[model samples]
Target: MDYSALRRRMVESQLRTNKITDDAVLDAMGEVPRELFVPRALKSIAYLDEDLQIAPGRYLMEPMVLGRLLHLAEVKASDQAMVIGCGNGYSAAVLARIANSVVAVESDAALAQKAQELLVDLGASNVNLARAPLTAGYPAKAPYDVILFDGAVQQIPDSIVGQLAVGGRLVAVLQADGPGRAILATRTEAGLSQRVVFDCSVPSLPGFAKAPSFVF
Candidate 1:
């Protein structure tokens, strides 16, 4: 398969048409080999316009969705960022290119190890890969300027919100009321304010599912 051509087409067609206009984001997406992030069996479909399941119930977001989320995060060169569910570290590698520093958290031990190897191979010196529960944000590197959940979730726990610095921003695809919505939540002195950015369908992260309530 001609992976390079496929990747270029993905950027020009899916990404550009979808409004991922940031030159930096586009360049990163174009240059980074998406095939390297997926298992060998699925490398051929790496650039396809869909999510590739990385594990049981876990998937890497489609390129367009990820690019849009990064653009919305407004990553700055001086910003400190954290990425939740850093599956294979593709998002962290992209964030590393734009942000000053990045802490990528992954819950699956095997995936975390794979991400670490890939990040090192990619020479992403500014990004650190850590293994932790998906819902439990890395507190040791708390107060991030930006927090990105690479997958969908049912709720954003205070445990995660507490890691953000005042005035910081968090972007995630959350299940609001019913269908999934991409939301940008910002921290303020008064409280957190959330706004839905777009409608999206993404695989939910494990351990983030809301428990059912008993009724009479």
Candidate 2:
């Protein structure tokens, strides 16, 4: 299969047509071999305009949504980044091209192992795969310049937000209510400042459900 040609088509059709504009983002997405991240049976459809399931409850995020969120995050070359729920490590590979270094955290043992292998094979030297609970952001390397969620979440836990360096940006699909919305949250001097960047549809990362509310 002509994966390279298919990737180009994806960039022009799925991405550019959908309003993904950042050059760094465009280049990384265009360069990454997405087909390598999915099961071989699904490789032909890996670049389809939807999230490909890697596990029962987790998915490799849809390309357009991922692209848009990263574009909103404005990842810089010198920044340290973290990818939460980094299924198959595709997001980390793309971030590795842009960010100086990336620490990708995954909770599922099988997925984490597969991601680590693929990353190593790709020579993603700056990307480190760590197996840990997704909700508890890797604090050992806290104060990251950028943090990205590879899936949707009902809310950003204070603990995870605390990992971002002041002035750092974290982006994710926040589906707290109604339809999902892409959010760009910046760790600020005062506190975390977040705003809706756009609307999106992304499967939830395991363990990010909002806390239950009490009623009278």
Candidate 3:
């Protein structure tokens, strides 16, 4: 199979048509062999126009959704980025090309190992893999210029938000009980401000959903 051709088709058909205009994102997606990130059984369908579940409850976000989120974040070449719940590290691989440095945090040990292997195999030298809880975020490398959640979350916890630099941006899919909406959050003098970017549903990463309420 010609992964190069499939990648081009994904960029042109899935990403470009959906308003993913960032040249760096386009180039990185086109170059990174997405098939390598999924289970071998699913490699042939890696470029499908939807999310692929690599684990029981984790997913590799759809190409278009990922591209749109990255575009909305406006990741800069000099930015220090962080990816929360970076399962398999596909997003981190793509981001390693655009950001000067990336710290990818994952809670699952299996997923973390897979991510580390893939990132190193792909020569994503700038990505620092952190094995930790998804909801907790990696505060060891706090003050990142950009933060991205690789999956949907019910809310952006302050624990994660505080890690962003004084003037940083965060992107993620926000969903509670229905469809998810991609959102971009920015930290300012007062507090973090967020705006919905688009509507899209991707699988929720482990530990990001809202805790169950006690019913009397």
RMSD, one per candidate, in order: 1.4, 1.0, 1.0
What does candidate 2 score on TM?
0.97
lDDT of 2: 0.91
- Residue-level lDDT tens digits of model 3 in 1-216: 998999999999999999999999999999999999899899999999999989988899999999999998889999999999999899999999999999999988999999999999999999999998888888888899999999998988889999999789999999997789999999998988989878999888777668899999
Per-residue alpha-carbon lDDT of model 1 for 1-216, expressed as tens digits? 888898899899988998788887888888888999887899988998889988787788999889989888888888999999998899999899888999999989889999999999999999988899888989998889999999888888889999998888899998746788988888899999999889988877778877888999
What candidate 3 gets wrong by more than 4 Å, as runs, is: 214-216
State which candidate has the highest lDDT. 3
Instruction: For each candidate in the order shown, give its overall lDDT on alpha carbons.
Output: 0.89, 0.91, 0.92
The best-first sequence of candidates by TM-score reads 2, 3, 1
Error of 2 at 96 (Å): 0.3
- Worst 10-residue stretch by lDDT in candidate 1? 175-184
Evaluation by lDDT, superior candidate among 1 and 2 = 2
Which wins on lDDT, candidate 2 or candidate 3?
A: 3
lDDT of 2 at 19: 83
Candidate 1: list runs displaced more than 4 Å. none
TM for every model, in the order presented, reads 0.95, 0.97, 0.97
